[model samples]
Target: MKKLYIDYDLFLRPAEKDQPHCSYVLRPGNDGPACLREEISFLFACRRCEDYPCVNSCPNGALKREAGLIKRSGFLCISCKTCSIACPFGIILPELLPYLAGRCDRCIGRLKSGEVPLCVSSCKNGAFRYVEEDDLKGCPDIYPMGDSIIVKVFNWLGSYGIKK
Candidate 1:
């Protein structure tokens, strides 16, 4: 399976309002035509950082840090805009607003095209890679946070008896 890799900086740019919203549809071999498995959700600002101050600064408990991922609880997000102000890397900005709905998207489409996400591809250091989660185990030093936020979010939701 292919995975999406994100370019954090590109995600911060404002979307042109006139741009058409494209959907990512998938067609399984058994399934008859293409079915809309999911939509291309808004790209969000990056949350990865060695010193993640924004995670703690969010008052609504919306920000979360994980290995290789920073997941936000959009349903719990009050959008008070505290996280945006607290990020030190300038990864979060006022114009890089969050989409009110949808799952955390890590730029899966770009990876399938033999390219990294825009931000990572543009990086001078070649910092990010879109690899299988299992493949990351051997390279622990890379993506040091490794999907911790994803697990945490699921656990948090489970604590409240939420199925998802």
Candidate 2:
């Protein structure tokens, strides 16, 4: 069975000897088509709103608040996408299957064994990291997109007297 995993590492800058050496990055993984997309991020997207709109939007009661986090009941879910639509930040994706609603368990067995999660240890470039949520303070929630061919053409045209 395929499992969804987080990458937990995002390199914002290249390594430089004179710059301050910073470590730690966490983001959603995009290993395969089945894996979570790099564009989505639970840590950065989920605001944990006071109203819990996602949970309340579940008509079948598939989502519930447990221990301050939203938990999804796969069996009860009909994949109606109500939760996703209700989420103001667009964190809960509508494409999510019923079973993937409340996916990450943080690898309980690994933690009990005094080891990091499989994704963290499996990273080849030493990019994966684990850090307290507090470290993410001030990090921007929105990320810029890389320019595409269409955007480049538009920019070039806009530089001239080309209108529309």
| lDDT against the true structure, each candidate | 0.40, 0.45
lDDT by residue for model 2 (1-164), tens: 11222332332121432121211223233122112221333323355678999888889998777655566676798888888889896767665544433333445566667766554555444433444444444653322222200000112223444322
lDDT for model 1: 0.40
Q: Model 2: which ten-residue window has the lowest total lDDT?
A: 145-154
Cα lDDT tens digits, model 1, 1-164, are 33333222232232543211222224122211000111111112242456777778888787676554455675787767787788775555543344443332343575457654443343343223344556445442222222421110112223445332
Point to the candidate with the largest TM-score.
2
RMSD list, candidates in order:
12.5, 14.8
TM-score of 1: 0.39
